[model samples]
Target: MSERTLLVIGAGGHGKAVAEAALLSGEWQRIAFADDRWPALCETFGWPVVSDVAGLAALEIQVAGAIAAVGNNAVREQWVEAIRAAGLPLITVVHPRACVSAAATIGEGSAIMALAMVGVDAAIGEGAIVNASATVDHDVSLGDFAHLGVGVHLAGGVVVGARAWLQAGCSAGYRVAVADGVICAPGTVLVVD
Candidate 1:
């Protein structure tokens, strides 16, 4: 059987992390990048920029899956939808060092970074990010396009709403519901009931 080709849909730092996760996953044979600003055949992140939307049709034959690595919640959502419309399966990338429970369900386009822990039955939504060393306890729910920055911790039963951003080192108590589109400051603590 041939190996799967994955397209990394950004050309930035997060995109590099996502590509590295894909590599760590060990399922993708070849990796390519696509960005709005890159030329059709330029090299970035040690990979080729196949093309943005304009070249998806031509590149589709070589790309079996894609992940939108954009860090911005709104742009990530848009890229997720665009990749769907183009009929490419969005890949969920979990780094090799991450500990994800078997009962956990991670949605497509999500990235579980290195050393992150996703506990039992945790539900991570599409395009969500669990950055390096973050902890998502059992029964936690991360909504679509939500981001948990590096070292953020969510106690069991925590619910992070759609497009919410928890900055680095933030921690939330159990049963907390972070509102949608909320931009939490770094190191913030929420003891919501």
Candidate 2:
């Protein structure tokens, strides 16, 4: 609605996906990528690669907000911090096709991709990622930088700790608690163990 521009850090696969989702959201008037590979990697998904990580300072006046589109949780957190320190607001990106309940809370710098379902009262922490086709049921709590890979499903009331990663096709049953920094393999199914 306003004259807002988004600077997405990271020009890799995850970054491209985030940028595409952001574009589909139609929330930003302009969007650009800033990666360490800037000059060598001039563009991604038809978007210009404007600057590198070190160049972020110069972009403070150019972009209204930013988001780290990195797949690595720890790296994303670091980029988010840098974006914050640069006085750029961290924005949440949700694809138009994603079914996110109005009661759900999506944190700053988080990205919810196409076909993802974020249920009522679900809490998505800062810099988190709900990748394509992921399903987070009601009352699920995802900590900061947590990543739910494509097709991953978390049943109701699941609590996933910070930096936890549930790889593709993984499924967790109701009320399951995943500790911080845990990395669940693809297709992994969690019971109430």
Candidate 3:
């Protein structure tokens, strides 16, 4: 069977991580990037930047699946919508090095990056980005479009609301609830009240 190419949405830093994760997954033969932000920058990290998903449709390229690697929750959600609207399947992209439990459920358009860990029964929501080396503990519930930045760690039973952005290296205590639209500063630690 011929290897399939994957269209990675978002050509930004987050997009670069997603493309790296895709490469680690070994699921695609080739990786292509689409970004609405940099329409003129034709190449990213030595990979071709073929415009956004809508542009991909215009180019009529065959993509087996896709994932949005946008960091901002709103932009990530928008990319998801655009990818779907462009008729590309939004896939769950995970790095081979990430330790994801079989019981854990990763939603569509979610990317689990290198060395990230998704514990048992954890639920990662749609368009969520589990950045490099981050940890989502067992039984955690992550709402739609949540972004756990690099090295962020969530204790067991933590509930992250939709569109929340937990900054890099932040640590949330067990059972803590981070509400939607919360943008945590780096290295902040949350303890159970």
Best-performing candidate as measured by lDDT: 2
lDDT per model vs. reference: 0.90, 0.92, 0.87
Q: 1 or 3, which is superior by lDDT?
A: 1
Per-prediction TM-score = 0.94, 0.96, 0.95
Cand. 1 TM to true fold: 0.94
Mark the regions of model 3 whose C-alpha exceeds 4 Å error after superposition: 37-39, 53-56
Residue lDDT tens for model 2, 115-172? 9999999999999999999999999999999999999999999999999999999999
Off by over 4 Å in 1: none
lDDT winner, 1 or 2: 2
Worst-scoring 10-residue span by lDDT in model 2: 56-65
Count: clashes, candidate 1: 0
Candidate 1 worst ten-residue window by lDDT: 52-61
**Model 3: lDDT of residue 152:** 98
